[model samples]
Target chain A: MKRRAFLLSAGGAAAGMVLLPQLARAEAGRIDWYTGSDQNILDFWTNIVQPKFEAANPGITLNLVDAGDNAGLQAIGDRAVAAMASSADPQADIFESFDPRLPKGAIEAGLYVNIKEAGLSNYSKINPLAFDGDYSVPYRGSQVLLAYDTTKLDPANAPKTFADLIAWIKANPGQFIYNRPDKGGSGGNFVRRAIYEVNGNDTSKFTVDNYSAEAADAALKPAWDLLMDLAPSLFDGGAYTAGNTPSLQLLSQSAVTMIPAWSDQALQAISTGVLPETTGLVQLSDLGLPGGFSRSVILANGVNKDAALKLADFLLTEEIQSAVLTELGGFPGVAWDYVSPELRDKYKDVIPTTIPVFPGGDWEKAINDGWYRNVAPNVVRE
Target chain B: MIIWPILSAIGRTLWLPGADGVSRFSLETYVFFFSDQYSINNLMVTLWTTGVCALLLLPICLPIALYLRFAKGRLAAYVQGLAIFPMFVPSIILSYAIIRVLGPNGTVDLLFNSVGLPKIRSPYLTPWGPVIGLVWDNIPLTVLILLSGLGAVSDQSVEAARDVGARRWAVLWHIILPRITNSILVAISFTVLGIFSAFTLPYVLGPAAPEMMGPFMQRTFRDLNDPTNAITQAVISFAFCIVFGLFYVRSVAKNRKT
Candidate 1:
């Protein structure tokens, strides 16, 4: 009798071991999100969004992975692309990109799931431009603007046109600054706008999808000439800052009067006391500034497609969009008409015009290379 | 376990099928890395910065190590504490602190102006900025290594040299330095590797065009989305480290034999 009882107990224990993992898998489903955004965005998702999401849907978990910006996105992209090539799952179900162009290549490689077909409730509220071939969902936007200290520079005398800006830079030597183009997009935006201004203020000629070296040379010759003319008049005799933050730091310390900066970042810095209250931002009237949106793409082979779609849709909700404006100081991913009046009024003057998307990968490479080779050598003093 | 992943990554760069669907072993990545002007420029910059850092650190570290070894008092302890304190501070905070103190019209400039001298522009925006930060960050480790080497030297040996009518400088030149040659090489190897693979200091302080290999490789892999070229850059960096590592090994082996 004792031997028979021991054998039955041993068989039951073995069965329990075999069934445990299956039970756990049935009980809990998890969605992994990869992002290269800053701390504020990370906090909003972790501290605010995650708990609310989990509460609404039981037995589901959301994992937020903070990757480093720009460069971090690339690392995640490479890994994800590699995993997809081997018919395996990537590290995350959702991938967040700092630049839309960063994910354009991956999307073309068919790495992302098409969330448009998921019939998300909040999809209609987003700006049409935010959709990238039905694979991406933009969450926030950053617009490039001329940020200046009001205590030093008269707002009325601020440059309105590219020509006016160049003259102002020359007149106030060592007071105006822009970062190197290859370092940050604000500087690249400044350079691209200059190229637009030189081509008879017609952005159409340069807005095509393909890159033509001959066409670029002809269109950008005058822009290079303009940059060469402005070189000697830059801050510290043409030695520019390395990145966006340094430029803002220089402005705050009264080292420089003005710099090209992201509108949302400038405001956020001011709110955090990094920039003084007297700091003001303005978009050029004659020469439009560049603006782009940050987007999220769901991987094609994600483990929990339903959860990923739900989270993406949730990020586009009015409540989250408002939080993006107030908490993170980001432009809403949805149309401005959907935003509160107070927030809309605050950014009315600095609202960015829709500029052309970056032409393509080859054009981008050429632009960065051209700036380093032809422009940086002449402008950089030491 | 670590070696397994590194070898796999390298193998992927050398043999993995590319986007064009060709899977064969090739030196194409190396050819691409060497042929690119930007990559070549970054490599040169990395070497230059590392070489300068090693040269700058030796004189500075040697004296501090010697002083700590010879001096006996609370002042030596305080100095040692000060040297080690910077290591406790995070590199990012240290970098920001350095920038604030050395930026245009910053603390240094303010001091110069207050003293009635012409206000000098800060070099923090230039290549020299990163060099200074690198030295500041690595001085503690370099000093620690040299101090360990100094411990191996005996005061009796120095006294014997003095009794033999050797001068202070001669004693230091012959007895002290020869005993610590291995230590100096070790310190130099650390500085070289630290500066070559540095990201935060150079990213915050150095110019954008001629970046260090760490940041350059990151940008190539992440921003440019070219993993093969990035791995190629990594392989080159590894080659440099290996050369210095070999020197370290040889010095250690020689010391053991002696």
Candidate 2:
């Protein structure tokens, strides 16, 4: 009799505590987001972005998938193109950190949503400089900066101009190295800036659509000469690091005093204690180093385009943008005014207010190849 | 099935899309690879690393295998264990350990400094870096193949040579060395093949430019973002590997006849 009373009271309590059962909503809206990496990128989405978006719109389910690596991401682009041509389901709704230039002219073909007119509530707050085109919705960004060891060189003495950098490199042989231009963005941007330096500060010729073999040859020859002149001063007597990480690794080991590194990665390494506390970062005053924004594109013909759009909008919202800045050491895609005041105050000194972007596409590829052929011609041992 | 990928890779190298968007036969990739000094440098580096590694493996592993074959004690077992130890360690881990030990201002340099020795010129990011790493990696397999070949020599053959006034050195040279010729061939064949196509150790330890074929192909694909060029590099690497592969096949066929 006592057990029955206890069971009845517990059942009553459970009944009282439970909310009304909602209708089954597996089919309501399952938006599959294909992010390229299963590392920090996936973690950012699954942990920070998903919970709030789903909580706000209960019926919309956020599905995370790892497309993984460049090849995998390219395949996803191809799939969208194929599905668009056949008028079938695109299968994927969202792609995070997707290269918009993939599939050649997918942007012009309307394969991706036009975010400017998509009516994202935070559209007004978007950083115009960071935004690529209507196809790309950049929510987070990072810049390449001159990362140097403070213990070895004082901030006052660190190079401020491209000319100073060259002079400093010459003065300190075997203390500076950049990765090979083709290997990583940090290295690529370093070469890009050097190209800018030698071409009489003409950033205009280097554009998203502006590239010609004749023009490149004329402009790049001087850059190559300048870089080749500086090569003998680099770490390991002109040896370049393989990538962004290796450059940093050499710095961490104190093998090199300076390198070009991504702001986010450098910050992350410093905070995570992978790099020493004495490692310092500074941007060049003249023709500042280029930075990039991570963009997410929604397929125009996605099965759950509306939900995907909503999620894209949510990524630009103040809370999420702040999270990107705090959590990933990434710059907010939204403008400084749109970011929380406390964060603005915290990062104003370290974060460049106007992050300059280098031209990508054909120009980047040409520069990388030309760099290999011209500048580092003597990389082979005798 | 294996041949299909190789054929496709070769096909990709020869067949390319023109600026006119018409598919046609082309030798542009090959022309570029052979004529371009940078590409040729990369090829030469690959060849150098393979040749050096294959050459080094015989000298490094033969002595340990010869000792293990005749010695009857726990010390031989320990020597065998030490020689084969690298086979268990992953290449990536080995590369890092090598970097730590041989990199600039690393353990060796620090120890040398403490003892008032001149600084060691680190080989961490030079052509010789991959050579050191590859030679260490191939030791186990080379020794094992050598030991098996030494097994055929028969102690009586060695003892008979010794009885005929042959010293230990003479017995080793005349009896042991002659008997293991096939094994040495087989070991060299395997070593050449493995070193020819190796990627990880070379990619990590080797220099940025003049990279090995494995890293060269990958850098062309992923970094240069030229899949076609990468495939061309692969086809060329395959051509070199095939030459070494033929030696293995011929030796095996010869052994079968015997």
For candidate 2, write residues A144-195 as lDDT tens digits: 9889999999989989888999999999999998988877889888888888
lDDT score for candidate 1 against the true structure: 0.80
DockQ top scorer: 1
Query: Docking category for candidate 2?
Result: acceptable
- Candidate 2 colliding pairs: none
Cα RMSD to the true fold for all candidates: 6.9, 8.7
Instruction: For candidate 1, write residues A102-162 as lDDT tens digits.
Output: 4447767877776677688988888775656677888887778899989988888888777
In terms of lDDT, the poorest run of 10 residues in model 1 chain A is A20-29
The residue-level lDDT of candidate 2 at A379 comes to 50
Residue runs of model 2 more than 4 Å from their true location after superposition: A1-26, A55-59, A69-92, A99-114, A117-119, A299-310, A338-346, A379-382, B1-35, B163-165, B218-239
